[model samples]
Structures are given as C-alpha cells and as structure tokens.
Target: MAGKEGKGAVKDSRINPFEDTVQRLRETFRTGRTRPAEFRAAQLRALGRFLQDNKQLLQEALAQDLKKSAFESDLSEIILCQNEVDLALRSLHSWMKDEPVARNLLTQLDSAFIRKEPFGLVLIIAPWNYPLNLTLVPLVGALAAGNCVMLKPSEISQGTEKVLTEVLPQYLDQSCFAVVQGGPKEAQQLLQHKFDYIFFTGSPRVGKIVMTAAAKHLTPVTLELGGKNPCYVDDNCDPQTVANRVAWFRYFNTGQTCVAPDYILCSPMMQEKLVPALQSTITRFYGEDPRSSPDLGRIISEKHFQRLRGLLSSGRVAIGGQSDESDRYIAPTVLVDVAETEPVMQEEIFGPILPIMNVRSLDEAVDFINRREKPLALYAFSRSQQVVNQVLDRTSSGSFGGNEGFMYMTLSSMPFGGVGLSGMGRYHGKFSFDTFSNHRGCLLSCSGLEKLNDIRYPPYSDWNKQLIRWVLGPKSCTLL
Candidate 1:
C-alpha cells in the first residue's frame, strides 16, 4: 500500500476512489450516531490513545518527512494535538449542551436558547508543515462537535501521510471518519462533491481554488492560509534577548512554520546590533555548521530548497547563507539591507532565511506593516509596554506577540487562524468546536399563546399599531 491507496485497504485508479467513502460517511451522519456527547467523548479519548500509542511511529515518520527531531516533533505536533484531544474530551459534555439566551419582553414566558448542531459531513484538507498537528487538531473539533469527517492530508509529506492514512483510521469509528489521500487532482475531485463544511489549510493561491469549488455547493469553508508575518524589533530592547527569541522561532522546523516571523523591522543602528546577536544565537542553536546538526530540519523538497537558495542573493548576508543541495540543507540564514522590492521581502519566505529591513522609527515600522497584507502573526519586541502597545494598536494581524515569539500557540484558550490575506475563520479548543457546530437560535413557546401572538398579525388600526409599536420598540424595556 503506497501512495493514495495507503488510505486503509482502499485502492486508487485513474478514477475517483472517494465516491463510496463520502456517501458512506453521509449515511452514517444521517443515523445520528455521532450526535450524543458520550459518543463524541469516546471518539476524543480514542484520538488521545492514538497519539499515545503511536508516539514513536509518528516521530519517526515526521523525521523521515521533515528531518524533525524528537523534541521539535513532540513540542509542535504530537503534544499540542494530544492536549487538544484531552481538552475536547474533558469539555465535550458542557460544549454539547444548549445555551440559554436572554429573552425579550414578549418572549419572557417562552424558552430561548442556542442549539449547537453538527454540520452533516465535513472535509478537512490539511497542510504539510505541521502535518499531524494541523490534521488532528481540526479533527478533534469536528469529532467533538459530532460531525462525520473526511480528512485529506497533504501528499507532499509522504511519510507522515502514510502513517495518518494507514494507522490513524484504526482508532476512530471507520463509518463516520475517513482518511483520503492524493495531490491536487484528488483534491479537485473531492472538492467537486457537496459537503456540509470544508476546512482547508494551505497557500492563498490554492485557498482561492478551494473557495471557488466550495461556492458551487454553497458549502461553508474555513481557509487557514499563509502570509509574510512581520517581526518589529524596537531599538529599546536588549539585542541578545530579542535575537534568541526571534532566531529560535524563525528557524523552527527550518522556517516552514506559517506563523514564523518572515522579516525584521528596525532602525539601522538596531539592525547593526541585532545582526551580530542573531549570528551568535543561530550558531548556538544549530552549531557553527548547521548542516551537521541533528536537531535542524532540512527543506521539504528540492523545489523549495532551490527557491530558498535563490533568496540568499536578495540582500547582503549578515549571518548564515550556506546551502547543500544533496542533503536538502540550508543553514539558519539572516540577510540585512534588503530592499523592499526584493523577492524575499515580497513573498512569504517559508525557509530558515530571515530578512532585515530598516525603518527609522516605531511609526515607520507600523506604517510598513500596514502597507502589506495583514499577516497571520505579528511581533513587536520592546521592554517598554507602551511601545509594544503602540505597535499593537496601529497594526492588524490574526494574532499578536508582545516581546515574545509564537508561545501563544501553547494556550488552548487562544484561537489560531488569520485575517485578510493571511486567512479567514479560526480554530483551537472551544473555538474549534464552535467553528464545526452551527449555532441555531431556537425558541419554544406555549401552544395556547395564539391570542398573545395575534397582536403581530393583523390589519392596520391606530390602536393596534400603537400597541404593536409599544411592544416591539426600544421603549419595551421601559415598560417592563
């Protein structure tokens, strides 16, 4: 079982293989088997067990696919996913209960609440960067919200894809969930079908295609796309402290992270000081020759390696700019004095390369950030709270980091998604459950309240109109 057929015992020819699977999932959803809180909790527990049982298998697959070390794999992918499963399991009962809402004067005697109902069948298309985390985290929400899910893992990450397709399905109820595998062609075929909901994580270009395909069936979608995230370094900060934080996140997973700081904004003087500090930090984290570092990950493929290697010429190399094509390795690199028109600055550099561009003041840094598409994550480093506040106040991003990196991801309380070009919608913990579930406004009234409702359905008269106005108007509160 290699390639797409690795999705359990299913086989893939030149034709569509998912037709039967999708229909079966929809049939399972119709049975209402997944709607119960106990069922959802049980599925979540099974997901947690899947993580615990296949920990070593997942780690090895990630290592094979991305050269991810055990520590990095655990921190970014496995642990976070496990925590999500645990959180959903702990909270599923409360999340499934109907929420009582405040009623107006006329409906005071009636029961009003929001019923969180599952969308029948869902499609989750995950990206390759954090394959397991991205795939399983969303799966937790879909399952917790009691929806049948069809998971499409990125085919580019072959090893992890294989593990997820073959091993993960054994944990969950096979009839209600599935792992569909393939490239763009397969995705296109999947998208052509009607689904209740679609959750996608990938590039903006492909996001547009997914959105377009979804428009045909009028299916709701959650597009977690990527953008060039900015990191602004204030002149008032300690160079070493800022460098260590920025470098650690910038090169994490060889900078394939969507939320990683893509570029640096600072004054010329600050840039000069920070460059040396960053050089020292990179050497410390990955060693003098990063190619020899077991902890450092390599680029995903030769195509991306060549693309990242091309960016090295965009600016003067202030730190590392080394590469080895045979090994698919690029050192944790930093480039300074980069022009705004350069390719590295223009695009999201999803590699270990970091570019630094000069801005005269905090105002300029804010202005520079605003001129571009809003990013998924934005960072402002300053010892002064006011400076950090000023940057936050002036700019918009999906998430903000003040004097830190992407540590906010660790907390399930915060949402993880983008705004504008970065992406749309959000997910994580309760938000994920909410995203998957439809909040239906519901009301139950007395069957014998016909006389009370007659005031709203009538031929016009001055007295009746006046009474209706009094009942529906803002002054109804005053009457109450």
Candidate 2:
C-alpha cells in the first residue's frame, strides 16, 4: 500500500498506455487543422456545454466518493470550469494574436516578435483529491492554447472518473479532447508516448516517477505536488480571527486539500489562548456532532480514515478526536505536546488533524520552519507589520497568506504551485494558459535590407568593428 508493488517483472503501466493515446492525438495536431480560431472556439464551446450539461452528475459523484457538498463541488469544480471557458471565449482571439516587439541594437533593421504556439499534443494526469477541478482546470488550459489533450483521471476516485469518461466524450471530440479511464497501467502507457508537454498533479513520490518518464522523451513538465504547508501565529493577532480562519481551512475537504495548513508553529505564550479560540470556532462552524453536520464533510475513504486515526494515538489530543467508520467522519482534531520528531510532523498530515508546536520566541519558530522543507503555502497571523515582514523574509513557501487561510489558492489570478519538494511550476488563469503554450521568438526582415548583410560578410576589419560598435552601443545623450 505504501509503494508500487510490481517493479521488475510487471511492465510499468504508467508509461505505455498513456503513450498510445498521445500518439493518436499527435496525429491530430500533425493534420494542421488545430491552428484556426474557429476550431479553438468550437472546442471551448463544446467543453463548456459538456460541463454544464453534466454538472449534476459530477456533483453527485463527488459527494458519493468524497462527501463534497453540492455548493463546494459547484463552486470549486463547475464555476471554475465555466469561468475558464468564459475567459477562453472572450480572449482566445486576442491570445492567438501575433505580438510584435521592438528591435534592439544589431537587429534595428529587422522586426522582432514572439508567437505563442501550441505544444502539440499534451497529457494531463490529474489527482483524486479535488478530482473534477484538477482535471478540468488543466483541460481548459490545453484547449485555450489550441493543443489536443488526453486526460487521465485518478482511478482511486473511481466514481468521479467514470462520470467524467461517460459524459466528456458525449460533447467534445475524442481526437482533440479525450478521457482515458484506467489505473496505473493506463497512466504508464500514456506517458511513454512522446508528448510536447505533460502536466501532473499528485504527491512528490509519484511526481518523481512522472518526471522520470517525461525525461525519456525530453518532454517539458509542470508538476503540482504537495508539501507540509505551515501556519505561524504572532502574539499581536486577534485570537477569534485566527481561530475562525484556521477552523474553516482545516475543515475544507476534510483537510485533504494540498494548500491546507498542515501544522502551526506558535509562541509558547500564545498556545493556551489560541487553542480555546480554535475549539470555539470549530464548534460554531459545525455545532455539536460534526459527523451529522451537513456542512462538515467526511474523510474521503477508509484508508484515509485509518491514517488520521493513527495520528491520534501518536500524541495527546488537545481537542476533537472523535471518529465513526460507518459515518466516515473524523472530527476536526488538534494536537498539543506534539514532538518535533513525531510521524505527523515529519510529513504532510493532509487530514482534519492539526499539530501545534510551541517555541520560545518568534525567531525560534521561524528558524524551525527554515530548517524543514519549503511548503506549498504558508500562513502567519499577526496584525503587526514588522512581524509579518520578518516571517515573510525568513521562510519560503509557494504562496503566502497573513491572518488568512486557503483563500489565496482560490484566486484565479494568482499562480498556485510549490517550490523544491512541493512542486515545480504554477498554473492558473493566464498562468495556466501560458503553461500549455509555447512562446516562440520570431524575427522578420524586408527583402530590400539584403544589402545590410555586407556589413557582416567580412567582419574581421577594425573599421567594420568600430562601425558595428557605433551602431550597437548604448545611447547616453538626447537627440536634438
């Protein structure tokens, strides 16, 4: 259950089947028919209709597997999908426009520009957590950039994957926008086939495998992986606001989110005050018996259920460690007296459980984080400008939120990704569009300028060198 079982004897499935699909899509890109605005618009419209028509099915499927509420599903999955389509609809014409740039020094006689071109066929391997949103978001980018996509949804979330496979092909073209359904075997097949680009979202362990596969073809990749996202609390911050923000974030998707606050590093003095506030805030959010609360969601599966349950046994539970397997519920739990070397502290908790580690001073807390791997997101609660600045300068995370939590990841305009072990690239809104598109440098020269080549035909002369320097040197004076 921890690692891939079959290594030597069994053929690696993550490479070969994924490759076959890409081979088919590559043929479509080779046809030269993908360059038209009409073709791009048609695909976007088809995708939009596909998502809208099957919105209810997707919402229900997510709820069945992950207990994701309808509002959460629609807001995170459907609205974002519609928004991407809207952006693509309004901007595809302009995004496809040829941009001209200023010519410099030696190239003054030539016109220079950059053309944003498609990366031919692309393969997007999405994660099970936030299955619909992760899958569709990348698909939007691929279509917006005018590239064919072969989407492979995680089999762990089988219900949602079945829904996507059943519904997506009804509206979109298989050759341009196809969904392949399978487990590790199918993913391996797809990765083996040469693709211009590969976008993968999952854990760092699997991300390494994807990167290794991509390296075989020298295909560029954008990996969105997880890290131990941390939270810091300064003494000056409002206890109520801090508690409310942390509770809401910890409960989101039962804390299965990649950007959720995994643990907190706070002052020893603020620990007692912060704990009560968080307990109160959690009660207010879900009331008593959070298992029965519709607003409060359940853990995604039994495996995750046992994993979080084991964390409770590792340390003293400070607040809320209730669980019911039949309900698939684990109350939002917080741990105190947690050792720095504890198993939960060593890796991303990725559950409703949160660990609070206390230090003597703010500097100590910052140093503790600095010593660990960089996280995907960092949150610090403080009203003091100096405290905020110090934390921001001291540690590195993919994104930052001060006195807030998890909201930054939702901002479509902001780029979302990790650094070091967290992730390799960012993709959202225009960033997403750029991730799937290749910007090519272009230069143009008039036929009449052919005589200018004489200056470079025999460039060994001192006179020519001086003449070239005169024309290419930086200007320091204003012309009359």
Candidate 3:
C-alpha cells in the first residue's frame, strides 16, 4: 500500500510541473516588474536578439521539420517575427499611452480617458504551421502590453519546438515568461489553470475545446482558427497571372498556411486555360521535377503526407500528382472535375494540392462561397474592378483579396483574424496590443466639484430637472 502511494505521488509530481510554472508566472505578474514600458522594451529587444543570433538555427530546424528553404523560412517565420518585434519596439510608447476621449457637459471639466491595462497573465497556444511567426507575433503584443505569458508551441513541429524550448528562454527574462512543451495532454492540463487572456491558433475542432476551457473561468480568448478558404478566378483575368498567384499561395509552406487558397471556383472555359497556365507555373517554379527542386518544401509529417496521397484519387490530376513516401514529398498538384461532395472538397486541403471546380458564373461562385462556413480569407482574381467589387459586396470573410493572394499579411497596420466558424478576435500590430489589454473606461472629477453636482440632489425642483435635461441633451455640433 505504501509503495502504491509513493508511485502515485511521483505521477502527480510529473503532472504538476505545468501548474507550478503558471503559478510562478502569476507571482511574477503580481510583482509588477513587467508593467514598466522600459522592461517591456528590453524584453522585445531580447526577442529581437534571439531571432538575429539564432537565424541559422531556426532555418535549419524549419528545414528539418518541413523541408523549408532558407528563403522561405526567413520570409515566413524569422523575418515576419523580427518585423513584428521592430514594429512593437517602435510603437510601444504610443500604444501604451492612455487615449483621451471627449466628454459631455456633465463631465466637461473632468478628465475622461481609456486606460489600456495589462490582463496580468496570458496563455498563447500556437499552431505548427508558421509556428514562430504565429507564436512570437502574439507574444510581442502580450509582452508589450505588460502581461506575463506562457507559450504552448505545437509539439508536431518537433525541430522548431526544440529550438524554442532550449534556446529562447536564455534570451528573455525567465520569471515573466515560460514555454511549456507537450502534446494534447499538456494542453488540456494547462487549460485547467486560470489565465486572464488566452490566444489560440489551430483548427476549429480544437478551438471549441480551448473556448470551453476558457469559459469555465470566463477568460477572454483570441481564437485564430482555419477553414477552407476559396479563390474565384474570373474568366476576364489573365490565366497565367491568376495561376501564378494561386499556385504561389496554395503551395506556399506546402499549403500548410491557414490563409492559403484551399480550392478554386471558376467557369469551365477558364478552368481549361487555368490548368495549362498552372502547369506552366508549377514547372517554371519547381522545375521539371519538383521533388528534386531545393526550393519546394516537403510535407511536415508522414501522417499528412499519407493524407495528401489519398486525396490524389479524388479528381482527375491535370498538373502534378506525384508522391514520394520516404522523403514525405507531394509534388505541386492540381486537380479538375472534383465533385463538391468529395473528401478533398469537403475539408481544408492543407497540402500542395489545388482543386479547381467549375462554376457557371460569378453569381454561382458567390453563392457557393456564401453557402459554406465563412473562411479566414476570400480571394477573387479579375481584370474588371466592378466584378471584384461585386464579389466583395456579396460576401463576408475575415479578409478579401482581389487580384492578389495573402500579401496583405505583410502590412502590420491591418488587423488579421477570422469570423464565425473560422475564428474570433483580431491581432497584428496595435490590434494585438489592444487584444491583450483591458480598455478600462476612466473619468477623474475634481474633489471640490460637489457643489456643481448638486443640480439633481434631494432638493430636485422643476427648474433643476429642466437644467439637468438641458445639460445632458445632445449637442447641436454632434447633430450637425
């Protein structure tokens, strides 16, 4: 009996490590050491150094995990994170300032403002695809907003995860930040703890679980989830250009990106032109054999590789449908005559596969998109601006890109997020800072203004009532 009790005690200790880390971070937050703007700036600078010093290490890890090229790693992960860090460092002061608001006659003499205060402790659960960018971008905002954070990076990306766990802590202040590593079990345990703010980036199925856990504590959440993003290419556009843009985004990161074009909707005539154009673009970009090209990335894991290999049978392969199991490589593939009811069409094809389905006209394409769950992004390629505007006016998505792909993500000024089933809440630049903060509505009145505030006191008369109404009424300038 004593032996069994001792074994149970040892088991409990193993599970308590994450709980202990969260408690420690909460204690650090109570100390108010992370609240100062200077401390936040120093942390941001350290993060920048972490990126700069370990650039090669990150590149190699990314390559090992996803076969990502040096250029792709820099552009998609390291550079994007570095840009976020730079933007936060430059704008931290302005973002941290209390915003002054207008007052009515009742409080014209008082100071009215919205104070952005940190939410104490924050939890960020990032996905495997674009792991560093997705994780660090939110981390920059949480830290800049002066919140102690706990980051849960995806365990699937083992190589990148190792670098983050092993090296990232050496750069930042350990007391105010921590990295907890594990699979779903660790995530489930972490969610049981109370965090002031929770930010998650993953699939909607897992997103629901995160929200359910957060609801237990009434914790605010920013869910950056994914969906089947649709791309509509009008017949009026140049087929080659449309194909280039679509192919680039669809196959970027081996199509593991949340915002990548999941499928294509176009007319029968346009589909014919697009197939050849896409074939040309794929060959041009990846050479005659994509598997031999050093630029193209391989699938992240054997499980995903097998899943993609199974999807090849869904439709008639028009461009590329080759796979190598040993290397976990799926050639840049495109399919036509794909039925809407097929498995490839029903789910997000997060692989190097693009399925083009025929739509009679723009109205049909719009109807098809509207009938499904709102996506993280919607794309339309057309030479006519009116056609683009028509699609934009008729649909709702987290973001709309006409004659482009996911290039809008490069601009930090725009808020990046999803709607409805895709996800909730916005982030990037100032949006991220705001998302991690509590906008406390505050007003300060003079201590000696009691006499002025007596208009509606116990001795309220008709004249005093009229005066109060007049003071509270809307201003003529406001009406104008």
Task: Write one digit per residue (lDDT tens) for candidate 1, span 1-480.
Answer: 222343334445557667778888899999999999989988999999999999999999999999999999999999999999989988888888999987667887888899999999999999998999999999999999999999999998989998888888888888788888789988999898899999999999999999999999999999999899999999999999999999999999999999999999999999889989998998898888888888899999899999999999998998888899999999898998899999999899999999999999998999899999999999999999999999999999999999899999999999989999889999999999999999998989889968887767778688888887777677665232
lDDT string, candidate 2, 1-480, tens digits: 101222101222432534444566688899966768888889889989978888888888998878888998887778887887888788888877888876556677677787888999888899988998899888888888889887788888877987777667666666666677767766676676788899999999989999999999999999999989889999888888899999898778889899999998887778889999988988888887777777777777788888888887756898899888887789999999999889889877878999999888788989888898988899888999888888899899899988889776667788888999998888877788889989988888777867777776674599888876666556722111
What's the distance in Å from true for residue 328, model 1? Answer: 0.5
Q: lDDT of each structure?
A: 0.91, 0.82, 0.89
The backbone clash count of each candidate, in order, is: 0, 14, 0
> Which of candidates 2 and 3 is the stronger one according to TM-score?
3
Off by over 4 Å in 3: 1-12, 476-480
Candidate 2 error regions (>4 Å): 1-20, 474-480
Candidate 2, residue 245: the lDDT equals: 91
The positional error of residue 387 in candidate 2, measured at the CA in angstroms, is 1.4
lDDT, residue 154, model 3: 88
- Candidate 3 contains a number of clashing pairs equal to 0
Off by over 4 Å in 1: 1-15, 475-480
- For every candidate in turn, the CA RMSD to the true structure comes to 2.1, 4.9, 4.1
Q: What lDDT is obtained when candidate 1 is compared to the true structure? A: 0.91
Models ranked on TM-score: 1, 3, 2
Q: lDDT at 75 for candidate 2?
A: 71
**TM-score, each model?**
0.97, 0.93, 0.96
- lDDT score at residue 236, model 2, on the 0-100 scale: 87
lDDT by residue (163-189, candidate 3, tens digit) is 887778778887888877788987898
